[model samples]
Target: MLKRVERPVLKDIKDACVLMKDAAFPAPFDSRLEFSCSARGFWNIVHTGMLIPEIHQVYVCAQGCLRGVVLTAAEMNAIDRFSNIIIRENNILEGNNEDLIVEGMGEILSKLPYTPKAVLVYTSCIHHFIGCDLNLVYRRLREKYPDIEFTDCYMNPIMRKSGVTPDQLMRKQLYSLLDKQELDKKSVNIIGNNFATDDSSELVKIIRENGFTLREVPRTKTYKEYKDMGKAAINITYNPVAIEGGIYLENKLNQKHLYLPLSYGFDEIEKNLDILCENLGVQKIDFTENKKMATEAIINAKNIIGNTPIAIDYTLTIRPASLAKLLLQHGFNVVSLYVDSFIADEEDDVKWLKENYPDIKVYSTMHVKMRFVDRHSEQKILALGQKAAYFTGSNNFVNVVESGGMYGFDGIVKLCDLMIDAFLNEKDAKKLIQYKGLGCENYDTNCK
Candidate 1:
């Protein structure tokens, strides 16, 4: 069973204020009194991150408040330079005015000579209050337009702190397609590639080498191809954020769902290989050559940084866990682990850690107090998303903020090299130290 972390309570008002300041803006308002002013305000924030890509087209259909405006900005930021087009719908509100939204969609649909690959309809908080069933709206639109794929993004504008994350929204959209696919017994589905760090090509190579056929679901997969997904023998979930869809697939197809951590470490790769071999009933590859390569690499790495103490704070729990296991095997003292969250079959991992390295400590963000241990640790390894990297003050250590996908034997070597570099470089070490408020200048400071 996976260990669960309790949520933290807020005690610092100043920290609360800082969180609010950093939070994304609330969705737009549609009242006559605030119409012009709200539009200007929304546009300013929108312009900061909005981009028109050429591959996909976005047509904003806002209802209630200006939630559509806020969502459009975020979507635009996510798709920058991806070759997509974004066009705003003229009728942005539907009070008792459903016709406005309908007509606006019609106008946009008519203007396009060819139906787009996908059509996303965004809704505000008002739409939810008014009981607008976007699923119904999408079904209706699909029946009328037949040629285009339709989806909806629910952006609740009223609750400042309750909006759906971009990741959640994207998963919701993708689930719609995954639900329609037929199950195959020999094929395997790959979940958790958000186009952010999903190196699909490399993943495919690894999966193929392990003797399983791979299918990836994205905008690129055709409707027919996606519908045939029910055939996969099993589903390998790489990212926790993608678990929602995996759950759906399990229920619908009765396919086995295995959650694996994404990391640039040999142990993780070995675990993944083990899972594939077991599921497919295939013989394990003689890892004699691969193991030798990995062993030699670690031996070389340890010579440069023997017995160094390292700390890791990452958005994904699997990354830290996998990387920590690798480093520990290479003679590093993994003092403290700070994880954002953990979602997987942790039976093996927990057992392995307890039986072999019982002294290593793991903490979730809620219970983490990094300053207490920073003085004792010689270096830190921060394998996190950009946001978490900045939040953890890892810039003071020899840190590497990688957004690209890392997997297989080659990836493990690269991760080991990064750790070695971090251990040896004073500049990198000092940067991380300052970021975490562990510099000599603040040696007496208490973070609590």
Candidate 2:
């Protein structure tokens, strides 16, 4: 039987505030050893950033490091696009592993049935420790494959917290491939997250009304289409990770960028839309109708979930604190939250929640105490995100895997629908949390 955890009661939202303010939550606990119930969300980001249709990959890493990704590639049916060069122990100690990598690249280009437009070479954390000079290896590969683009991708999990994460660094490298082109003030590029925004997005409607074309990498069908994104005059980033890429484009290509971070609060969303319009020099498009629809959805959900205690997790959205604040404003009883860390950009939301809703409890997923099941609290309730459902014993939960296809007014509406559905339905949250389902159809990689 699974063990229950002791509910860490906060004196109020003020005590919850100390959790993020001073990092007093938990000790360093590794979650990799735990069996992952769902990796579909993470693979979505990988496919979005790494799996360019015309670009092939050559992954250099230890056999152990390659096992999971290799399996993932096979599952996605994208095995043909992936190649690996196993790094031996001697290679790391003696240095000079260029020959192995060059040989792998050469084998792929010469033997592949079709030509690849580019080749992305990835190295694991072993290189971080041994300091493998990849620049020289890249130069050699460039000489050998002058017709194809070569990019150095890193898969370093060790530096996830210390520096720009693998995802953030990958964003910078992806945009660096865009060749300089003539600016198009009528065009806009969506950077950062791989998922394309739904058509109902107010931001999309506003851009279309202004006669601007939206360019998103995931929606681009070909390599040429992806490259054409460089011509965009404005880069609008939805996720914080993509801000680094936007900054790079501004510095390197002189492209203008507007950061439109996703928000659940209607007022904040309106403010973000205003900022976007100002940056693009487009007239403020009226969002009153969409706002009303979103407001109605929220009201309907609130009516069904009146005073029901809730738990939210960071995996559902980027700004958990912001979402919690919004929920509290609507009179939702958010009894607990499961968050590993506070995102630097959303610190203000955390502060606001601290001051306003001081009664909500906070739990750290990575706390040393979390290693052992605390057979204590039996508070079953509605939850958002899989992790939150598990920790709170919530049977009614919204299983939003990632921030894909979620943004603007449409995002708000969909979230409201999910919350309502969870309230109306009876679900086995424990079973849902443990099921290791197949990859999502949108990002399936079927490799033999």
True-structure RMSD, every candidate: 12.8, 4.7
Q: What total of clashing residue pairs does each candidate reach?
A: 22, 11
TM-score, candidate 1, is 0.59
Could you give candidate 1's per-residue lDDT for residues 295-384 as a string of tens digits? 777788778767655566553234565666677766866665544333344444444555677666453333223212222223454323
Report, for every candidate in turn, its global Cα lDDT versus the true structure: 0.47, 0.73
Per-residue CA lDDT of model 2 for 1-448, tens digit only, reads: 9999765743333322233334332321234333232323343324544435588877899998887677656655677888888999887777758777888778778888888888877788887787777888899998988899898887788866677888788877777678888999999988876566766788887888789989877677788888999999989887888888999999888889888888887777999999988887878868888888887888888998888878888778887888888788878888777776666756777777767776666766654444443423565488888777765656788876555567877788889899889988967666555432223332433111
Error of 1 at 253 (Å): 5.4
Question: Candidate 2, TM-score vs. the true structure?
Answer: 0.86
